[model samples]
Each structure stands twice: as C-alpha cells, then as structure tokens.
Target: MTVALMWEARAVAGRGADLLAWARAQHLAGTPLRRETFRAPQDRVLVITWWDAAYDADLPELPEPDGTLVGRPVHRWRFEAVD
Candidate 1:
C-alpha cells in the first residue's frame, strides 16, 4: 500500500519565510519515497510525503512549528493511492 501524508500550516504574519525555512530543516526518522514542500497565499505552507506503508501504519511526520512561527495549529491528512 502507498500512503501520502499531507501537512499544512499557516505562519504568523510576516513569518512565512521563517516557517518555510523551519519546515525545510526538519528531518524525518525514516525516509519517504517522495517529499515536497509548497506555499500558498496567506502564508500557508504545505508538505506532502509519500510512503510505502499501509494507510494506518505508523509514520514519521514533520513536527509542529513553534507558536511564534505559526498562527494556528497545523493541519494534516492521509490518503491512499487509488487506481
């Protein structure tokens, strides 16, 4: 099974760059099949990671940023590939 984990967060005003850099610096305990980072309007940062595991399997995910860096709690989702 292939699973994709999505992590998204909104940085505090004017702290988007800092949040992005912080996110980029994080390291996972296990390597993923693929990983990518992205940004959107409103200082939102999104990271998607693809893994070779069951949808409900335990996986290493990026941790939440410091309170000063983010405006609110981070959001996350999991999806399984479909054919």
Candidate 2:
C-alpha cells in the first residue's frame, strides 16, 4: 500500500526563501515532496507539503525545520493506494 504524509506550518518573518530552499534539498534527497505557500488574512504565511507514498517497512524519517514560529504545528496523514 502507498501512503502520503501531509504537513503544514507557519513561516517565520522573511524566512520563506530559506525554508523553501531546505524543502527543495529534501525533495532532491528522495522524498516525493510537493509544496506551496499562501498568505493568511492577517498576513501570516502558511506552508503546506505533500509527500508521496512509501511502504511502512521503508518509510523514511522526515527532516525538521530549523526556524519557524513557536505556535506553528505540523500534521501528517497517511493513506493506502488503490488500484
């Protein structure tokens, strides 16, 4: 079965570029990552990443961000692939 991990977090002021660079490096390192950013009504930045499926036995540990807001939270969701 295939599984996806979804993560969301708030970016620090003027830190989007750095965070994106890190994410790109992670993608190149072999995680099938799709990412995007958007602005909140209050002008804060939100980043979301979708990771491609990996087998439970072969799952890789995700990298952690160096800098971000204190209250920002990350979430993950997993799903099985269907034929």
Candidate 3:
C-alpha cells in the first residue's frame, strides 16, 4: 500500500528556512519518497510526504523547534492501491 502523509506546520519566526532545510535533509536521508510544500494565504506552510511500506518503516519523528509556532493541527490521509 502507498500512503501520503500531509504535515501542516506554522513557520516560526526566523525559522522557516531552517525548517525547510531540515525537511530537505530528511528527504535526502531516504525518509520520504517525495516532498512538496505549499503556502496558504495566511502564510501557513503545508508539507506533503508520499511513502511506501518501506518508506514508512524508515520514517523518523519530526523535530520540534523551541519556542516555535505550530500549525492548527496535524492531519494524515492513507490510501491503498486498487485494481
């Protein structure tokens, strides 16, 4: 099965670039299949990750920045292959 995990996080003051860099490093370390970022009108950042079973097994816990702003909440969606 394939799973797409959508993680929404608020960009902390002076931390947006750092957060993005960390995410990029994680992707390069083989954590997720593909990663994409989107910005809302309110400046909220949304990150989407696509992963397979293997990728899921290698998933890592996200880092939390001290005194950083967080998004409304975290949400996830799962999908399976159909034929």
Candidate 4:
C-alpha cells in the first residue's frame, strides 16, 4: 500500500510568492512516487507527496520553512491508500 502526506502553510501578507518558491525548492526524502503543490486564495500553499510505504512507516517529511515566512505553523496530514 501507499501513503500520502499532505502539508500546508499560509504565508504572511504579501509573502505568498516567497512561500511558494520555498515550497517548490523543498525536497522530501524517500523519493516520493509523486509530488504536487497547490495555491489557495488565502495565500496558502499545499503540498501533497505520495510514497510507496505504509502510513506508519518512518519517512522523511517536508521540513518546516522559516517561521518568518509563514503566518502560522505548518499543517500536515497522513492518509493510507484505501483499496
């Protein structure tokens, strides 16, 4: 089974671009089977990474970006494939 890791963050006012750039440059360990990013209306950046492992497996996750760039702490979710 595969697991998906979803990480999200909101940037400070007028800093969305910088936050997106920083997210684009990030590299998570385990060499994800697939990775994607999204931007929301409220200056939010969302990153979803698919890995070939169980949800409980120990895998490298996207590290937190500098606190100065974000309005609040990063958010994360983990999901296991259903099938």
Q: Provide TM-scores for the models.
A: 0.98, 0.49, 0.54, 0.95
* Ranked candidates, highest lDDT first: 1, 4, 3, 2
Residues 1-83, candidate 3: write the lDDT tens digits.
66666665555555666556554454344566667877654435567777676434545434443345443444444444456
Going through the candidates in the order shown, the clash numbers are: 0, 0, 0, 0
How far in Å is the alpha carbon of 80 misplaced in model 4?
0.6
- RMSD (Cα, Å) for all candidates, in order, is 0.4, 4.5, 4.0, 0.8
Candidate 1 residues 1-83, lDDT tens each? Answer: 99999999999999999999999999999999999999999999999999999999999999999999999999999999999
Between prediction 2 and prediction 4, the one with superior TM-score is 4
Task: Report the error of model 1 at residue 79, Å.
Answer: 0.4
Q: What's the ranking of the predictions by TM-score, best on top?
A: 1, 4, 3, 2
Give Cα distance to truth, residue 3, candidate 1, Å. 0.2
Per-model C-alpha lDDT, please? 0.96, 0.49, 0.55, 0.91
Q: Name the lDDT of candidate 4.
A: 0.91
Best prediction by lDDT: 1
Which residue pairs in candidate 4 collide? none
Residue 14 lDDT in candidate 1: 91
Return the top candidate by TM-score.
Answer: 1
Deviation in Å, model 3, residue 81 alpha carbon: 5.7
| Candidate 4 structure quality by residue, lDDT tens digits, 1-83 | 89999999999988999999999998765698999999998789999999899879998788898989999999999999996
